[model samples]
Target: MTNRTFMTVEEVAAELDVSKSYAYKIVKQLNEELKKLGYLTVAGRVNTNYFRKKVCYSEV
Candidate 1:
């Protein structure tokens, strides 16, 4: 298992510079994708490493 943990919608909003509603939408979308892949998801939060990869693609 990885050390990566989950992030709240507030953290997602700050990280994406988006509104809370938008953050919820993003989380919901990610959660749906995870569900399709047979992974369990939590409400109002997302996996940190996955979130980073989704939004921080420019990092080295």
Candidate 2:
């Protein structure tokens, strides 16, 4: 995977093997959660580490 601080919607879709629309929804949901936790969020991207953790992507 390329080194990136945030993942775009396309990247999220590709990584999760889901459609772009679904990826957008997922990003929105995750962003909302982050906002609730008082974390700043960008509009069409998510923090890479947060995404991996939320999706349970192990580094093993």
Candidate 3:
């Protein structure tokens, strides 16, 4: 229904009229949880991506 894009922690904070520190904390915690589920990771400073599913390959 919307064309908005993913937002960084600071952006979310500004949009929500909340503290940046709180946003940063929530983002950091969520990132950790995502890592545990193997659905997200950091490509660089503050870069995170979520895949729809897991992928794996094995060599015989």
Best by TM-score: 2
User: What lDDT tens digits, residue by residue, belong to model 1 across residues 1-60?
Assistant: 245589899988987799999999999999898899899999999988778777775342
Off by over 4 Å in 3: 1-5, 43-60
**What's model 2's lDDT at 40?**
100
Candidate achieving the largest lDDT:
2
Clashes of 2: 0
Per lDDT, what order, best first? 2, 1, 3
Question: Candidate 3 clashing pairs?
Answer: none
- Model 1 TM-score, 2 decimals: 0.83
Clashes of each: 0, 0, 0
Per-residue error for 34 in candidate 2, Å, reads: 0.5
| Candidate 3 global CA lDDT score | 0.48
Clashing pairs in 1: none
TM-score of each: 0.83, 0.92, 0.52
The C-alpha stretches of model 2 lying farther than 4 A from their native spots are: none
Better of 1 and 3 by lDDT: 1
- Candidate 3, 1-60: lDDT as tens digits: 122334476654664568988767656765676678675544221332221111112121
